[model samples]
Each structure stands twice: as C-alpha cells, then as structure tokens.
Target chain A: MIGVELRLMLRRRRVWLCWVLLCAIPALVAVLLAVTNLAPAPGQGGAFLSAVTSDGQLFPAAALALVLPVFLPITVALVSGDAVAGEASTGMLRYLLVRPVGRLRLLTAKLVSVGAFVLLAVVFVTITSYIVGVLLFGFGADAAVGGAGGITSLSGVVLTPLQLAGRTAATVGYLALCMLAIGAIGLFFSTLTDSPLAAALGVLAFVVVSAILLPLDAAAGIRFYLPTTHWLAWIDLFRDPILWRAVREGVFVQLGYIVVAFGAAWANFATKDVTS
Target chain B: MAGQRFSRRWLLVAAGAAAIVGVSAVQLPAAALDVDAEALRRCIRAEVPPYVGYAEASGRLGLPEIPQLESVTTLLTTTTRIRSYVAGADRWRADQLTGALGDSERDTYHLGAAEYVWDFGGNQLTRVLGQAPLRLPRAGDLLPPDLARRMLGLAPGDPVTAIPARRIAGRDAAGIRLVPTDPDTTVGRVDIWADPTTALPLRVEIAARTGPTLLVSELLEVTDGPPDPAVLRPVVPPGAGAVTASAADLSGALRDLRAPPAPARLAGRARLTLPSTPGSDLPGVGVYGTGLAGFVLIPTGRDVADRAVDGATAAGGTAIPVPFGRAARIGTPLLSVAVRSTGRRGSLLIGTVAADVLQQALLELPARGRPS
Candidate 1:
C-alpha cells in the first residue's frame, strides 16, 4: 500500500511540488521573521498595538492567517480532494482494484498517506516558525510572573531551550488536530467527483462557507459547533492554565467528524459500481 | 510540652491580629465606593483617553502647534547616549541614534530617544489615536494610598486624578474624567466633562491649592489610528544635515539646552473664572488664573486662542492669559526618565510610565552653549 501511494504521488509532479512549496513558504517566512523583529520598540507604543488588536478571535490571527487560508487548506484540498478523482482521471485506479487488495485496504492506505502528508506539512511549518521566532525574539524569560508570590511556579515548569521546543511540539499537535477536520471533508469530497479541480474547489468552497457563517449575526447555538469552528482551537495553546475543556471538545469533535466522513465514504464507495 | 504551648499561643495571637485587620477593612469609611488597586487600574485604562506623545520634524506635523485645526497632538520626547568599544574602525557617528546595547559590541549609542504620540482618538498609547473629542477611560478610584490621598486633596506639585462621569460630555464618554497635578501627587478628584456622543470634554476643571488650572482643551482633530511614523521620528529634517561623530567627545551625556517658557503675564484687571457646574457646555468647572491678574473661565470646545479672540471681539484695552502656558521649549535637551508602573502592582506602568522617560530626559538638560 505504501509503495502504491508513493508511485501514485510521484506520477503527478504537481502534487509533489505543492508539498515542497507548503514546507518552503513557512520556512521562508520563518527566516524573514528571524532576521527582523516585527514588533515595535518597547516604549514607542508597540505593546499596546499588539494587545488591543486581539479580539474574541478563535485563533491567533497572525499564525493562522499565514497557515489556514494559504497553506493548510490548499494542501488538504490538493491531496484529499484528488484522492479518488486523480486515480479515476489517470485510469490507474482500476488496475489496482482488479488486484488481490480489498477496496477498504486500498482506501485506508491512501488516507494514511494523506494523513502523513498533513502531519509533515504542519510539523515543518511549526519547526520553521519556532526557529525563526527564537532567533529574533530571543529566549528572554518569556514571561515574568510579577504577582505577590514573586514568580515561583506552583507546579514544575521548564525553562531550557530544549524544554521550550517540547512545549511547542505539544502546541503544534493541537494545531494539527484542528486542521484534521478540513482534510477529512476534503477526503469525503474526493470520492464525490471525477474532476480533481472540481473536488479541490469543492473543498475550498466548503471552508469559505463556514468562514462566512462563523461571523454572521446568526451563528449561535448548534451552528457554532460547525467543523471549521474547531479549526480555530489552536489558540488554546497560548492561554495560561490551558483550557483543557476546549481542547478536549475540539479533539473529540474532529474525531467525530473523521468517523462520519469516512463512514460516508465507505458506505458510498462500497456499494456504488465504479465502471466509469 | 511547655515550648509547644508557647508557640501555639503566639500563632493564635497572630491569627487574631489578622482577623482584626480584616474587620477594619470591612468597617473602613470609604468601603462603599472602595475599589481595589486592580479594579482602579482597569478603570484607569478603560476611562482615560489613551495618550500618545509625539514630537518630530518634516513630512509630518512638527512639535509646532497648528494655528487652529480643531485638534491637538499630545507628545513627549526622550534622548539617550551610549559609548561602546569599537571593533576595527570607529565608523559609527556618535550623534546618530543607533546601536543595540545588550550584545555589548562596543557600539556607542547616542541620542536614543523615543516619542509617544497620541493623535485624535487619544490612545493610552496607540488604541484610540484616531477618534477625536476623546472621552478618556476612568482609571477608577483605585489609586494607591498616597496617590488616592493626594488626588482627593491635590496641591501644587501633586499629581491630579480624573474619572469619567456622565454629566460632563453629554454622550461621548465611556465615562470620562481628567485631573492635572505636579509630579509629587497622583490625581485626587477629577472633574469630567465630555459629550457622551462626541466623547469630547466640554471642560476639564482641576481643583488644586495653586488655584484651579482649567484646561479648556478642544478636540480640534481626531486622525484615527496611528500617526505617521515619520512624524514620530526624532531625526533632523531634510537640509538639517547630520554632523560627524566625535571620538574625543565624552560630552554626549551632557545637557544640550534648556528653554522653559517665560511666565506670561495677564493684565491686572483681566479675570479668569472656572464655574463649578452649569459652567456652560464646558467639560468641567475648572478655571485657570494667571498670577491673579485676571481670570477667564475656560469651557469645553473653547481654546485659550478662542478666548483670546473672544477678548478681542469684546473690544477692550484688556489682557488674556496665554493658553497652554507660555508654550515651553528646550533645545535638544537630554533626559533620563524612569518609568515605575502604576498600572498594576507589578505589571510595568505601560501607559503612565511613558511620561516618566520624557520627564527625566528633560530634567538634566545641557546649558546654553553647544559644548566646551
């Protein structure tokens, strides 16, 4: 299954190139950020500008702004949106179906590869950003707990550079989970169409709809529980005393969506004839 | 057994004292309107109009106040000079404001100062720089013990305290209040005047022992968002050619100049009054007296310039007090300001402390001559 997935990916150079670009863009951005401090000087009103601009926004608009609209969704759509369609369009999927491998196993392998690619893409972006951030921002005791206790930690806390990297790794894990739902939806749609562009576009269209709906005056109640809303769960990484409730909910919701998406794909692909 | 009994007795005594102190807090006279330091800090940020200190030249509004633009730029400046070891050649000019000190590369830093510019909206530093007729946030009655006491009975050299109340500026205020006092005292009682709708002060009447100095400051302009960065730059203007760096000059820290404005005089019969309330549409009832010569009651939307014009319109061999004092000036003054946060207990006084840096830089200014 791994050999087949590799062959399939290599056959289409554009997909390979996209994976490269996805990693490269963030790395380049990280480099630029490392070279210069984007924040203004201490006294010249820079701090206020940084603080006041935040809203009840679900994501740190800065990181997500760079990631979601451009990288994550684009990558997801390219891979998941083209899964079944690309195979059908190139006429290579049939030869495999006639082989000994079961249909379920075939879908599982492609999905795993898609999952691997998503994790790889997110990890690269995370590491690149971290390196750049550390270089430019320096490890200046990131926070000074100026309360009456005079900055002692109640629990064990880590301060070494290596520890920071570990902490950041956990944060990236949370972010990757948030994007999983987007990739799931794309995977579901990949089975719905024969044209890769149509499928890819369909995935983006789904994201755009949610993005628009999230802000309208009516997105309360059950509507707030939409898939993309969970996509913004990454901001939980920054809050002190991390709100585990929100993180737990986010994880479960994406898991729920993944189950439902694959369930639908299985039901549809299992029964429908693929003669065309 | 005897030692244990003694220790227990002492612990009980300490506990009793703690209880008594707790009871005193509940019984304090100001308990009804009493706000903790944190609540007061929140109020201050919420109520006070964010202030931005700006002073720059060229391609922007210079420190020079415009004739009458219906706005103002609250600005302050600070400067610093540092000398470091040179690597190969001493190429860095001493006059230029450059160099990172933390790394310690022997790069000398000179004229390293920053300006805080609050445009129309009146930011604590940046947030409200654009919206005009600003109704500053109420820093609340959460002043520290000394400041609260000083604010209540403000005197000359005492800091002034202000809060936003509904009465002053109609509807423009979130709740606006302003007070002015010397460095010695934090603001005590502040008279707030703002049109809630316009958020502009109709009058800001400050009561102090030195006589109530009323600021009839008008929101002449509110250029929303940040002022132009170039306007915030401290560099010399075009054709203001840069001077060469001096190696032998350790006089970098020496004061460059001092030019506090000469006290302006009012005509002997001139009068300035600050009516307590119902003082017209002004933000407060604060008034300014020019050495007791004459008094003019300053109302909101009425600049001293407007008052001067009004005095002229009255057609009299009369006198009007100069607005905003005599407009103080100092030539290339060097300052050393220390900002101690009054915002939170330990959260650096982000907004209020900006003033300290500016104040310190001006304190140890250089004399009249350029240098020895």
Candidate 2:
C-alpha cells in the first residue's frame, strides 16, 4: 500500500515541484536575512541595523507570517486533495480496491506520506528562516523584552548557539501542529472528493476564515478554539515565564481535530462502495 | 461534500474575525502625557537644591582700643542664590534660604563665589583681583533625571520665603529681614528674619516638597539680601578699612568662595571662563555697575585696576543693577550686564556671573559716587 501510494505521488511530480517552488519566497527571505545581517551600505548601515534590531520582539510573529502562507493547511490541502482524485482520474482506485487489502489502509498510507511532507515542510521553514535571520541580523548575545511588565531581558545562556536554536525551534515546532491539523482536514477532504480542485479550495477556505476570525472581539471567548490562534501561541516564548498553557491547549485542539478527521475519514472510506 | 460545507462556514468565520480585531484595537488604554510632564517638572524643582549666594566676614565699624586699625570690615557674598536667599540675607538670622530653585539641577552642581573686592585705608594700599570674568557651573552638575529622583512626589506648587531674625553677622547686629517662597508648593508660610537699622529682612526660608516636610525642622533659607549692586561688579573702596594683600592671599582669605579665580576686583588679575561657551576667552576684564548717581562700567583689569565699582550706586537711595550677559541692560534686581565683545569662542557676560559675589564686592565700592 505504501509502495503504491509512493508511485502514485511520484507520477504527479510537476504539481509537487510547484509546491516546493511556492516555498521559495520564505526560504529565500530566510537565506538573505542570514547572510547580510540586514546591514545596508555603510551610509545606511546604522539606520538599517537599528530597524532590524527593533524587530527583536517581532521574531515569533515573523516566523508565523512566513509559515502561514503556504507551509500550512494550504500545502496540506494541495497534497491530500490530489490523493483520491489523482488516483481515480488515473483509473487506478478501482484496481486497488479489487485486492484483498483494506481500502482504509491504502488511504491511511497515503495520508501518512502527505503528513510527513507537511511536517518536513514546516520544520524546514522554521529552521532555515531562523538560521538565515540569525546570520543576517547578528543575534546580539541577548534579546530584550519590554512592555506591560516593564523591561525584562534574556538570551543565549552560553556557547550553545545550538541550544538557543533548539529552544526557538521548539516554539516553531509547537506552531507546526496547527499546520498538521489543517493538513488532517485536507486529508479528510481529499478522501471524499473526486476533484483535487474542490478538496484544496475547501481547505483554503477554512484557513482564510480562521485567520480572519481569530482576533475578532465577537468570538473572543471561543476564538482560541481555532487553529490560527494557536499558530500564534508560539509568541508565548517571548512572554515572561513563557506561558505554555496556550501552546499546550493548542496541541490538544490540533490533536482533537486530527483524531476526529482521521476517525471520520476511516469510517467513511471503510463503508463507501467505490466499485462503480 | 465536506468541502462545500466547510467553505460556507469558513466564509462566515473570516468576516467575523476582521471585526474582532478592529474593536480590540480601539479598546486599548492610552497613557496620560501631560500629567507625567508636570510631575517631572515639579521633581526637577524640588530635587535640585536652589542655587545660593553667601558671604561671611568679621570686623569693627570704628577705632577700638585693641584694634591695630581704625576700622575693619570682612565682607563676603555669593550668587549661588535661591531668589529668596537674597531676601534671607536681609533678614536677621545669617543662615537661611527661602524660594524656588533654578530648574537646571538635573545633575550634581555647586555654586561658588566667583568674584570678590577688598579695601584698606590706613596702609594707603589697594589691590584689584580682576579675573577674565567667567563662572558657569560645570555641566554634569545639574542632570534633570537625578534631580527628579531626588524630588519625586513633591507637594504641588512648592514655594518658600526667607526673612531676617534678631542675630546679625554671627553676633548681634541689626537692620534686615528676608522671605523665601517655594514656587513648587503654596502650603507653608514665608520665613522671616529682620534687622532694625536698615529695617531690611536678613533671611528667608521654605521647604521643598520632596526633601523637607511641612513641619519646621528642615526649613532652609538665605541669610542676607538686597546686595549693593557693586557686590558682584568687583571693586574695593580707598578709605574704608586697614589692610593689604596679593590676589593670591585674597583667594585664600576668601576660601569659602562658591566660584573660583573670583571675578577680578580690588585684589589682582587673571583670566576666567564663565562656562559661557566652549571657546570663550575674554581678554580685558572689569566690573561695571550703576549706583545712586548713574551706571558706570569701570575697567578693572591690570592697567586701569586702580578703582572698583559696586553694582549699586548709593546716594540717598541705592540703585541696584542686575547682570545679564545675554544683553547689557542694567537696572534694579539684576537689570543686565552686557557682554563686552565676542572672542575666541564667546564674549564676557557681566551679569551672567553670579551676583551674590557682587554683594560682597559692595563693601569695596567707594562709599558711592567716588572718582574712578
């Protein structure tokens, strides 16, 4: 089942290449940012550096901004949306179901592969962008935190740039689960649709709506229930004492979405008669 | 299809989200700036000690048996003045201050006797100490933040007044009263000290909201006032006391001076930069003052250093002149001392020099209306 899923995905290399190409912008931004430290020509160097340094507080926000566009549910939808449709359009689903193998396993293997793709895309974006940012803007030995509670500061506890990177990496990783949850929804959409366009657009609509509704005052009590709000939970790292409650709650929310979507998809796929 | 249902729900969600953010943005509270600024100003006023002017001396008015001289008078004055400190001087008690401090003490600062005038008649000797005429307190002396820390949470409109008491010149002399007011607060009464002879108040005092309480113990004020305008103009009279000394000896004798190299007067001569500007160098020096008769800007440098002038002219009534280096207009309560001319970096400003020293210079002024 896994081999068959792999072969089918490989056949659609053009669309996958397009997905990687779509990731090029944030990757390039991360690279350039790492190299130049964002310092401009000598005359403007001071001003440019000041501007960049001012963004110290904006670190988590920027990470989310880069990941939200494509590495998220959208990618999830694109890959998963193509799953059943691509197979059916190629006239292969009927041949596969004719085997003794359960239809659910075949779809599960496909779901796992797409889930790996979503995880790798998110992890790469976070690492590459951070490395590029640190390289481009000399991460002064420390970062300054201010506002509400007044000025508090923290930074690299030591020679371990890796350790510091690891801590920051954890924050991005927490955000990644939101992307996977979006992917799960996409996977569910993929199993039900015969057209890849319909599945991908369905996932896209949910993401756009979540982003818009999260900060709305009307939904304040329940807005945090959304995936996009948890995407921002990464910002908790910048707060004093690092409020991980939101991050933790976000994990549960994403997991809940994934279990429900997967459970519902399995049940649907197990009973559906695709023989026609 | 799941896609169809999800798309519809997502569309409704997106619209709701935009509205949530917009309302939250408007609801955030803003800080009040004006109140903070006023509080800061009050802090500066209360924290920075008021600049003071003072002079101390010992002498007899007429020939006494044990005295080697017919009469002796040790006179001292300063421009490190709290406005009411001058009034404090006129009051009876010699030690006191009352009034608003200048607004610039954000850092450490000291007010010194920058000028002095001395004279003697029996020895037929007279010397002039004519400095280049400069005395601006060093920069870091008045940092606002430090002053604010020292004077935070002071009572509003804190003001003080100083007045004279019965004691005069360390002993019991009479003839002045002084009053001090704290512009920072209006709660307390003006301090008063009096002298019967001149009927002038000798000392004034008040409390800073931050430093002193409304209670009486911490009150501070200037002990003397209404300085003879010539006090800071740098000059000494010919036939008054009995003495002779070099500018160096004078500098030593006037060791308590708040200003150094004291503005040249009856002692000797040297150059002085009054913290006027970065590259200010005044070549010629003198103390110009107006008295009961008229205003005279006497050249008191080495060559024409024979005579000295008081900031005040005493006829039946004394005309007091104030110094302002920015302009050369002289009148009562520091009319204005003009800058002679600009030089290397800037010019010499007469009034810009602290006037409490001029108050000491007054004793050296020829009784009044004497030949230059």
Q: Score the docking of each candidate (DockQ).
A: 0.03, 0.01
Model 1 Cα RMSD, 1 decimal: 22.0
Q: What is the C-alpha lDDT of each candidate?
A: 0.37, 0.39
Candidate number of the best lDDT: 2
Q: Where's the lowest-lDDT run of ten residues in candidate 1 chain B? A: B341-350
How big is the RMSD of model 2?
A: 25.4
Best by TM-score: 1
Stretches of model 1 off by over 4 angstroms after superposition:
A6-12, A30-65, A135-138, A141-163, B1-372
Output DockQ, candidate 2: 0.01
- Which 10-residue span in candidate 2 chain B carries the lowest summed lDDT? B67-76
Worst 10 residues of 2 chain A by lDDT: A148-157
Task: State TM-scores per candidate.
Answer: 0.40, 0.38
Best of the candidates, DockQ: 1
| lDDT (Cα, 0-100) at B6 in candidate 2 | 54
lDDT of 1 at B51: 19
